[model samples]
Target chain A: MRTRWIFGTILMLTLVMGCAKKKIETYPAGVSSNQQIGAQTKPYVTNHQEEQTLSSVQEQQGQTVEEQNLQEEKLKQAQQEKEDIRKIIAKRIFFDFDSYELKPEARKILQQKAEILKKHPEIKIVIEGHCDERGTEEYNLALGEKRARAAYEFLILLGVDANRMQIVSYGEEDPLDPRHCEAAWAKNRRDEFKIISSK
Target chain B: MKKFLLFSLIIGLFGVDFGWAKPLRVTIYGPAESKIYVFVAEPINLDGKKNSIMVQEVVQCIKVKLKLFPFFKQLSPKDILEQGKINDVARIDYKKFFLSRADIVITIGERYLPDTGKTRIELRTFDVFKQKMILGKAFDLTNQRQVVLMVRKYLGDLLQLIMGNKAFFVNPIVFVHKGIKKSSIYQIFADGFGLKKLADIQGIVLSPSWSFDGEKIVFSVIQHEQHKLGILDLKTGNMQFKKLPGNSCISPVFTPWGDIAVSLDFSGSPDIYLLDKQLKIEKALVKHWGIDISPCFDQSGSKMVFTSSRLGNPHIFLFNLHNNQVERITYEGNYNTSAVISPDGRLIVFSRLTPEGHRIFVHDLKTGQEKQITFGPGNDEEPFVSSDGYFVVFTSNRSGKYKLYYTTINGDGPYLIPTNNISTFSPSWSWVEEKYF
Candidate 1:
C-alpha cells in the first residue's frame, strides 16, 4: 500500500511537469521591445523631433557637410533600427474608418503578419483592436473588437492556430497621435499584434 | 452649512450691499482662478447691521476658503471707466457694468432675504455677446452643504452655458472592461470614476444597450457553446439569460414588457428577432437582403435604429414595426453603423467611416445635420449615446492600448480612462439613471 501511494504521487508530479513543459514549449509570438509605445511621443511628432535633434547634434560636432550627411544617415539608421524593433515588437494592421470588414490594404498588412506567425508557430499573440476618436466610447470599443477579430480570423484562415491567438479591443482610449486632424485619426484606427510568450 | 450661511449673507447684501449714492458698476473678471472684484462705491456704509451682515462675513470667508471664487475688490472710482467697454464675459468693464466706477449699486430686489429659513439664491446668466441676461437659476438652500453642492453644480452649468457645453465639465462616459481576457462586462464612468462589473461570464459577451428604464442592460453573451441574450439588473446585480439557437448573437435591445429586440446573425446573414422576457423567440422582425445588425429600440419601442448592408455599404436604417417600412437615415458617409437613438428619439449618435477614419457622429434627425464628435489618432467607432444624450462613450487607441474614452457629445478632449493595465473594449454604456441629479 505504501509503494502504491508513492507511485500515485510520482504520477501526479509527472503530470504537472508535463503541462508546464508543454506551455513552455511554445515560442513567444511577436517582438517584445517593451518600447512602451504609449510613453513614446506621438509617432509623427517623435519622428519630426528626432530629425531636429539629429541636426542639432551634427552642428555641435562641427562636422563637414559630407560628414554631417554621414552622421545624419547614421542617426536615421539608428532611428530605423529602433523602429524595426518596434515593428518586430508588434505589427500594426491598419483599417478603414468604422468598417471592421478588412480592407485590401489591411489584408496586405495581415499577410506580412501571417508570415511572421508562420515563421514562429510556437508563439502566442494577442491582437489589439483600436479605433480613433469619433463615436461613443462603448461603441468604438465593440467596433475595435470586431476589427481585431477580423484580423484574428484572417490569420486563423492563413493557418495561424486559434489557441495561439487572442484578441482585445482598446476602442479609442489610446491614440498614436493626439491631434484632432484627419491624418491623426487615420493613424488611430488600427489592429496591432503583441507576442504574449515564446517557446 | 458654512457655504449656505455665507451665500445667504451674499444674497442679503444684494439689496443694500450694491446700492450706493452712485451705482458703482462691478464685473467679475478672468477665469475661475482670478479674484472677482466688486469695484465698490468708496468708504462704504460703515453701519448696516454689522453683526448680522452675514453677506460681508461670508464674502470674507470665501476670500479665505475658496481658491476659485475670491472676494470682490474695489476698482478705481471713475464715472466712465474704459478698458474697451468690457466686451466679453471674461473681460468686463467696471465703468460699463456700473455707470460710475463707484463701489456698489443699490438696486431693490437685486438682493432679497426671505423671512423663512430657506434662502433663494437667484443667479442671472448673461450672454457675453448681447450683454443681456439669457438665463436665470434660483437655488433654494437651507444649509451649507446644499449651498456648496448647489454652487458647484450650477456654477459649472452656468459656465457651460456661457462658454458652451463643449468647453465645460467632463462629460459622462461608459465602457466595458473584461477580466484578464474574458471575464465579466464592466461599465466605465465618464470621469473614469465608477467601475461596476455588470456581469460574470465564462464565454464572450458583446454589445450592451440601455433599456428605457436605464435600470436594466441588455447584452449579447456566448455561453454553453451557444449564443444567448441577457438582461442585467443594475440594482440587484442579477443576470437573466435566454439562449438563442445559433452561435452568433450581436446587438440586443430591450423593449416594453421586458421584451427584447435583437439582431442575430447566427442564421447566415444578420437578421432581427423579437424575444419575449423569458428569452423565447417571439418572431422574426426582418429577414431581407444583405446583413442587418446593430439594432437599438426607440423610447416607445415602436421603431428601431439598425445598420444594414443591403445597399452594398453598411448604413443606419430605421425600421417601423407597425408599418414594416424601412428607410435609410444616413446618406453622406459610405459606412455608418451602430446607431443609438436619443431618449427623446430626436437625435441619433453613430459611428461613420470617413476619409479621416472611423469617427463618432451625431445626426439631428430633424435638421439633417451631422456633427462629428471624435478627432485625432485612432478610429473612434461604435458610438452609443447616453440615456441623457449629453455624452458618448467610445473606443480609441489614444493611450496606445485599446482602452475606453468618454467625450462630450461635441467631441472635445476625449477623456482617456486612466489605466495602464489590461486593455478594455466593446463598451456598452448603461443609460444614465433617472436620479442623475
Candidate 2:
C-alpha cells in the first residue's frame, strides 16, 4: 500500500508539471510567466478569466509589432540594393569622334551593366546615344544611335535581355560638356544609361 | 548736231561708251564688269512736309532691297545728290544720271493726302541709258508698317521687269532661334525684316521644312528625351505631334507630292522613309544597314539628295525616283552632310568639314564639279537654296555666335541677317504666296 501511494504521488507531480509548462508555452515568448502571475495578482477587482484574456491579447499585440519591425528591415535592405543597382547602371560609356565602335574600356563597363541588368529583371533601361558637335546634326543623330546600339548589342551579347533596353540618339543636341574643344567633344560622345522603370 | 554733241559730252564725262541700242537687261549671272549701277534718289515731299525720318526710312528700305541683287551696285544717295547739285538740276535730270554712269534710277515721291488721311507713295524706275521710264507703281499706305510691304512690292515689280525673276522678294525664310532652355521657330523676310515667332516649342526644334503649299510645316521636336514629329498647320495655327516607332526623328522635309520624308530608325537603322499627310509611314524610301538621313527632294520630285553612310563615310547621295538608282554624288569629302538640292535638280549645296571648320560647298550634278562656297573661321552649315536657285542662305558662327547669313549661289556677299542678338540656325527658305504674309 505504501509503495503504491509513492508511485501515485510521482505520477501526479509529473502531470501537474506538464500542464504548467503547456500553459506557459501558450503565452507569447515575450510574455514571461512571472509577468503573467504578477498580472493575475493585481489588487484591482477583476474576473480571473477576463484577466487571462487581456494578457493573451497583449502578448499577441507584442508579437505583431516584432513581426512588423522585421518586415520593415527587409524592405529597407531591398531598397538599398535597388539604389546600388541604379547607380551602377547609370554609368556612361564613351566613344570616339564620329565613330560608334566601342572601346575596350566601354566594353568592360557595359559588361558590368549587363550583369546588374540580368540580376534585376524588373529594371527597364534606355540607352541614350550622344555625339560631339563636330558632325552635322542629322548624321550625328544616326551616329549617336549607332553608338547606343553598339552598347546595346554588346549588353545583349553579355546575356541582358534585349527587351529590357531601348535606345535613343541625342545627336549633338544634349552635350555633357558645352565647351567647344576636343576634350568636351570626347566627353559628349558617349552612351548614357537611364533607368526607365524599376519594380 | 546739238544732240550728238550732248551725247558725246555725256560719253566723255562718263569715260565709258554708252550703248543706247538695247534696254539694259541685267543678266542674272552677269560678270562684275556688267554690274548695273543703281541710283536711289532722295524722297521728294510733294507737300513740302518735314517728315525726314519717314523719308530716310523709305530710302533705307529701297537701298537694302537693291543690295540683295549682286548684279546691282547701289550708288550712295549722298553722292548722287552732290552730283545733281553740281549739275544744278532740281528735278530728276536723266542727263546728269546718265553722265554719272547710273544705269538704273529709282525715284520716290511721297505725298500726304488729307482727303483720305493716307500717304501716297509713287515709285518710278527709269532706264537711265534709254532715257525712258520703265516701271511705275503707287501705294496708299495707312500706316508705316505697310511701308516695308510697299517697298517690297515695288522692288518685286522692278526686279521682274529687269531680271524676270522675283521669287526672292516674295519667299519667306524659316529658322530656329535657339534659346537658353527652349528654342523657337521664327519666320523672317529674305531681306531680314518681319521676324515673326512661329512657335515657342518647349524643347529643341530642329529641321523645319515647309510644304509645297506653304500652308503647313513639318519639323522634329525633342522633348523629355523623346524625339517626336510635329506638324504645324499654319492656317489654323495648330500643332500636332506624333510619337514615331523609333527614338530618332531627324530632318523632316516635305516631298513634292506633299508627303513627309524624314529619317527614322524603326527598321533597326536610320533610314529615310516617306510618311503620309497624317504622319503614318507610307513606305521606306532609302534603307541601308548604314546611316541615312536628311532627304531633300527637287521640285519635280524626280530626284532626292540626302546624307548617307552606306559607303562608310557620311556623303551626299542622289536617289533618282524615276529609276530608283542610288548614285553617290560626293566623292571627295570624308564627311559631307546637310545637302539640299536646287529646285531644278541641277545643283546640290552641302556642308563639308575641313581642318579649319565646316564650310559650304556646291556640287554641280552635271559637271561633277564641287566648289567650296563658304570659307569660315567658324563652322558654316545648314545651307538652304532659294526656290529660284539664285540665293543660298545658311547659318554661320563667323560672328562669334551663330547667325543667319545669306549669299548668292556664286558665293557673293554672305551678308549678316540681323536676328536681334539671338543665335539662329537651320534656315529653310520657301516661296509662300504674298497673301499669306
Candidate 3:
C-alpha cells in the first residue's frame, strides 16, 4: 500500500512542473496560450519574463499614486487660500454721521486688509463708499467720494500699489441697512472692499 | 382813488378783449394781508340739470387754480352764495361783493352740447371796486379730462389782465419719488393734476433738472456703486446713461445754450463741468478744491449759483459767466445748498439747515436781503422757484412722510401738493409750452 501512494505523488509533481515550463515558453515568445494553461501556470514563474512584466506594472502604479497625492494637496491648498480671501474682503469699516474720517477700529481692519493684499499681489480691489440718509443727495455724493478717497489714500500709504485699487462712491443710496435709526445709519455709512480680479 | 381811476382807464382802453390785445401791468407784492380778495361764484349749468356735474367739476378746478396765485385771497363759493344767488354776470350784485370785501368777482357758465359731444365754458372777471367787466373768454372742451386745461387757460388769461408777469398754470414740475429698492422720476402739473412717472430707474435718482425746451431732463443716478449721468427724453420716454470719469456726479443743470453743466470729481475734487448734449466733457465751468456742486443758472444763463464748501462749509456762490467772476452770496448759514435763481434774476431761493431742521430761504440779489421762507417742524429742503417768481415749491416731511409743498416768495402758503403717500424729493419746476401738454 505505501509503494502505491508514493507512485501517485511522484506522478502529480511531474505533471505540474511540465505545465509550468510550457506556459513560460508560450507567453514569453508572444504566443497566445489557452485559458486553462495560463491559469494553472501563474504561481511558478517568479523570476521569469512574465514576472518582470508584473513587477514593472506595480512600479508604474506606485508612481501614479504618488503623483495623484501631490495633485490633491495642491488643490486643497488653493481652496484654503480662496476661503481666506473671501473672509478678509467681507469685512467692512463704518463711519460716523456726515463724517468720513476713519476711526481707530477702521484703521486696524484696513491694516489687516493691506497685509493680505500685499501677500496676494495679483488681486485687484475696488473700495466702495456709502452714506446715511440725513443729508441732501448731491452733497452726500461728494461726501461719499471723500470717504472712498480716504480709504484709497490709506491703502496706498500701507505699501499697496496704487494701481491695484479703484474707488467708487454710492452716496446716500445703496444703504447697507434700510431702517431709519441710529443703528441702521451707522451701518449705512461704511466702506466696503470688493475683489475685482484675483489672477 | 387813484387805483380805481387807473383800473377804469385801463379797462376802458382795452375793452372786453383786453387780455387778447395786451397784458396789463399790475404789481402786487408781499403776504396774504396785502393780497386782494377774489370771489369765485358757483358755476351755473346752462342746461340746468344735464350739465350740473360738469359745471361743478369746472368750478372745482377753477378754485384749485386760483389757490396757486398767492396775491389773491380766494373767497369760498359757499361764502359768496350765502350772500346771494349769482348765476350770471348780470345777476352778480357788486354791492354784496363789496360788502364781502371782494376786490374781484369771477363767474363761470358751462353748457354741454349734445349734438357735438362737447362742452362750452364761458368765463368772466369783473372788478368789484370799479364795478366793471374787465375780461371775458370762452373755451370748448371735448371731454371731462380737459377741465383742468380749460381752467388753466382761463386763469392764464385772467392773470395776464391782473398781473403782467407770466403765469405758473401750464408749467410742470419734475421730482424724485423715493421707493423701497429704487427711486423714480415723476412729472406733475403745477396745478397738482396729471401726475406721471417719467422714468423708473433701477437706482437712486437725484437732482432732476429740465432742459430749456422742456423736452428732456438731466439727472444723476447712483448705480453699480457709482453715480452716472442720466438723460431722459421727456417726449420719447427713452433713457440714456453716460459713465462720467469721476467718482461722483451731483446736481446737473442745462445751460441756456442747450448744454449740460454738472458736478464731477475727476480732478480729485468736486467741480462744475460743462458737457455737450451727448454727455462729452466740453470744459470745466467751476473748478475748485473744496467740493463745488449744485449748479443753477438764471433764465439767460448769464449768472450761475452753486453750493461750494470752499468757505469751510457749504455756501451758495454766484458765478457770472460773462465776466468770469465768482462771488459768495450766502454768508448767514454754515449749511446752505440747492439755490435756484428766479426767472427775473432778482431773487435766489435755497435751503438752509438749522438746529430744528432745514428751512427754505430766499436771498434777494438786488436788495441783498435774506429771508427764511419756511418754518418747519420737519425738514424742508430742495426749494424750486416758479416761472413767475412768486411761488416756491419744496419737499417737506412735516406730515410724517416727505411730500411736495408750495409757498409764495413771501412764505405765505404752505399748501400740500397731493402726491399720494410716497416720499418725494428734489422738485424741479419748468415752464412747459402749452402744445407739449
- Per-residue lDDT of model 1, residues B100-196, tens digit only: 4233221111123467665454443332223333334555556544634444444445334323332112333334555533556665555443455
Q: Is candidate 1 or candidate 2 better by lDDT?
A: 2
Candidate 3 local lDDT, B252-363, one digit each (tens) = 8898888999999989889999998678999998998888999988888899999988877888999999998999999896788888998777899998888778899998
Once fitted onto the true fold, the runs of candidate 3 whose alpha carbons sit more than 4 angstroms away are A1-35, A38-81, B1-33, B45-51, B76-82, B112-117, B141-143, B165-167, B178-183, B235-238, B432-435
The residue-level lDDT of candidate 2 at A194 comes to 96
Better of 1 and 3 by DockQ: 3
Candidate 3 interface RMSD value: 1.5
Query: Model 2, range B195-221, lDDT digits (tens) per residue?
Result: 889998888888999988888888998
Q: State each candidate's chain A TM-score.
A: 0.55, 0.69, 0.73
Candidate 2's displacement at residue B393, Å, is 1.3
Each model's DockQ score: 0.05, 0.51, 0.51
Where does candidate 3 clash, by residue pair?
Answer: none
> Cα deviation in Å at residue A84, candidate 3?
3.5
Report the Cα lDDT for residue A156, model 3: 89
